[model samples]
Target: MSGSHVRLEPLTMDHAAGLLEAGADPGIWAWLSSRQPVELGEAEAIVKAALTDPDRRAWAQIDLASGRFAGTTSYYQIVAKHRILSIGHTWIGAGFQRTALNTEAKFLLLRNAFESWGAQRVAWETDARNLRSQRAIERLGALREGLLRAHRIRPDGTSRDTVLYSMTDAEWPGARARLLARLG
Candidate 1:
């Protein structure tokens, strides 16, 4: 649950307010398909629902040095029997981006799923136009599995292509090691 620079913890009701506060900027969700929370109450409600889901996995990123709420992430296409999961719903506050907070958060999640839960693979998907996210996933050593054109509608009420990336158990150890090295 904890990583070197950040802690990937279960998203609880308590983090609702912090998430809203960190997400106050509407522009933050520009690239994400989800609706931006207009207020704290809305943020709380959405996070509350995500936490209680039986299969959909959600996690909050915590900054180790300051212990502040960094952002949130989740696994949606959960296939427990196949030991496969997908990491999505990811968005780090502007202050947290490009800061290695994301790398550390993912390293912990990948480590947990593959190491702790014996998962065969973990996945990541993003808007195909989101070049930044695409690169970030590649840096973690996730192979470019493929692209789902016209994947889904965005919050702006338009469609977007989805880029899929993944890391298998065999690749996680080395990927994890590289991520850790970047932290130093």
Candidate 2:
């Protein structure tokens, strides 16, 4: 999917080097559920798995001006029959954080999910400790649904409390307007 300053292409093995470059800062992965890849080989493995994941679709975010990889995102826990899906596993390199890159990237994804797919709801959940992510979700006009205590097991074997958020079909009009204003 393409946006003014950012675009998302299918995640592929070819993006390994770009992922490594974008993820150079170790702190980028601090609150992520997946393990941080410390080497190109590890990044390659992760990309390989994402490419073949049956239940999810992954995309590599690209910086339009520089044509560089910025991060990765995915549509996970998809339930087509119910017209629901969760957008998670998103991370942007430190350089792109706080910029409109994230806003537009999200705008594109949400547009696709709701407008194109006719989804009734789109969900997001983040580690309870991730204040940045929490704020971002709220900024996108998603409602704080609730908390799921010990919702997931992290890569390091620790249980994580997840804070849930969502935007329903009824809420999308307002959310879309807000996102578009941010993108502007």
RMSD of each: 1.4, 0.9
Point out the worst 10-residue segment of candidate 1 by lDDT: 25-34
Displacement of the residue 31 alpha carbon in candidate 1, Å? 2.4
Candidate 1 lDDT over 60-122, as tens digits, reads 899888899989988788898899999888899878888988888887788888888899988
Q: After superposition, how far is residue 1 of candidate 2 from its true place, in Å?
A: 1.2
Best-performing candidate as measured by lDDT:
2
Give per-model TM-scores.
Answer: 0.93, 0.97
Give residue 23's lDDT in candidate 1 (0 to 100): 86
